[model samples]
Target: MAERTYDVMILGAGASGMMCAAQLNEKSDLSVVVIEGNEKAAKKLKVSGGGKCNITNVNVSASNYLGDEQLIESIFSQFSKEDLLLWLEHRGLKPVLRKEQYYFCPKSSEEIIEILKAASAKSDYKFGEEIISLSKEEHFVLKTKKRKYKAKNVVIATGGKSFGSLGASEIGLELAASLGHESISFLPALAGFTLQKNAFWMKELSGISFEAEVTVAGKTLYEDMLLTHKGLSGPVVLSASLYWSKGEISINFLPKNNLVDLLHNNRRLLSTALPLPKRFTQAFIVHLGIKDRACVDYKNDERALLVSAFHTYHLAPAGTYGFSKAEVCKGGVKTETLNSWTLESNILENLFFAGEVVDITGELGGYNFQWAFSSGVVAAQHIIENNKV
Candidate 1:
């Protein structure tokens, strides 16, 4: 192995790593290099947003994420949602906004990946190189399986361990710990939930979906709830999983209509009167231990029970589907240890953390990618601005 020197060495050529390398190369004459373990870069980004790549959300705020709220807010302040869009458009990556405010590449995820590759064309990328260890002595000394590299600054853009099959690992976390950074325990977030044995009835409602509101851990989201053979999923369930540490998740099966009023005047069967899938209604009423009697025959108490069942159906999940099915991990290196603006470690000189590897995990949508890109840009900007002096 030969000794190589560079201005900065970024770990993991994912979203943040690519962004930082591209911007840094563009702004200054700094020699930058990206180290990746996988055969190709941005494997996760290539599969994101169902292959279309949700670039960023039109609406982003401090409340759209979980972690050090102050740190997250300050990061966004340096790089806002509009700032990201302008940067993308300036780079000729025109994205389309759909499903309300989510920005996605109309062609495919490859469009965004291509743009990133082009942007970072000047930076050297070493794929299939796994980082074994790192140490700082005047300059950051990083060791990989294939070679040794030294740099003035280091950026750990390796994402959280979500899709292990895509080559995600805990190396970033381990490296951060080695450099004296705090971390919150990692858990599967934005993933499906396996049901408890008590609510095994939900399995029968597999393939059935309804637009409902789900609440867990004091946060509520209104989106499509999907019933699966293993458990619950879909937009709302996945969103709720981010907040669900451990507790019962409540759902409003009928959020759009007042089921009680419909039940008061109708003689229709309990399964037929309410606005829900017949299969779901049948399973729900049966699980409630109520026969499919005419809705009008129910007394006030019975009606109340029905209302409660519809409005506040609570079930404790056995556990999440794990990192294999998670879109992102819920935790990472603690925020207090890093400078909120530059993402540089407070205690470690010229060392920074960015992307999902940091403690801040955004909600489902493009918030995660935005955080990655923004934090990466922030770190690179600080380096570029300071290097000029």
Candidate 2:
């Protein structure tokens, strides 16, 4: 049989791959094909955000990501979240804003998927073909378990290794490495942390959640924190995990109230005066090795200790919950090796990268998806301009 060939071939039919193919179809007449390992496309998109995918966020900036800030800023400038919303709105899919920040599909993730499918109607799709190897000579050659294919330009949209069940892998990173590009190994991001032995008492307060502030790696995030069987998991902790590699994280159990002011002249028990969940406060008081007594009975040193314990609780996490529970993965092909404007590899000609595969991971919310879409469009636009007939 004859091997398939195309002007451009995109790996992974996830958010980035589909967006790139859609852009190419809209702006250029190049023969485009999307190759996906899964039987269908957008497997992760279909399940993300509990089926109603978070399309983008109200506030999007380079600060929301853990990567080359300048590169991210460049990409966002070219295709900002506003551009994304306009693109979707023009396609008759208006994402609804949830929690006054995140924009989610009003109905389901399928809404956006269908729009992408329609936009890329001119492109061909080869599903259930897992790429075994990729090599470039005159044209890039890709081999799958089923057959071989070739393309003039290739976009590695193969995403990070987060949802392994959804067919996520480090193939994109591996491919870039084979072509002489440096990359950091992927690690779990936006995931919960397992407690160290000293923090095991937190497990006893499982199911308790409260609004608090978490400070790690010089960044502070205020959001709901959940105490779980493992240790801690919630928006604040997950966001903090993005910056936390090692060392202690500070958690303010009462971020809104001043511990000193709350304790002043109050005669109530420590557990009842702090305005936190009784169970959590009791556990915390016990863990701190301080007797649970009337607030007025505490000495000056004890008051200072209580104040610090409530406002600047510090603990080191053993590790993360691993990729199985991770929403995204950090570290991939370093951004230094790619064109900031186009996401094209400086090391190899005709090679581009987009989405999670490019070493840019966003905190929990819609930032990751926004990055996927923005990077995809930027790469596709460059390809279209270069391949113009």
- In every candidate, how many clashes are there? 0, 0
lDDT of 2 at 147: 85
Query: What are the lDDT figures for the candidates, one per model?
Result: 0.89, 0.93
Indicate which candidate wins on lDDT: 2
RMSD of each: 1.3, 1.2
The stretch of ten residues in a row with the least summed lDDT in candidate 1 is 1-10
- Model 2, 209-236: lDDT tens digits are 9999999999999989999999899989
Off by over 4 Å in 2: none
Residues forming the 10-long window of minimal summed lDDT in candidate 2: 1-10
Clashes of 1: 0
Residue 291 deviation, candidate 1, in Å?
Answer: 1.8
Can you tell me which runs of candidate 1 are displaced by over 4 Å?
Answer: none
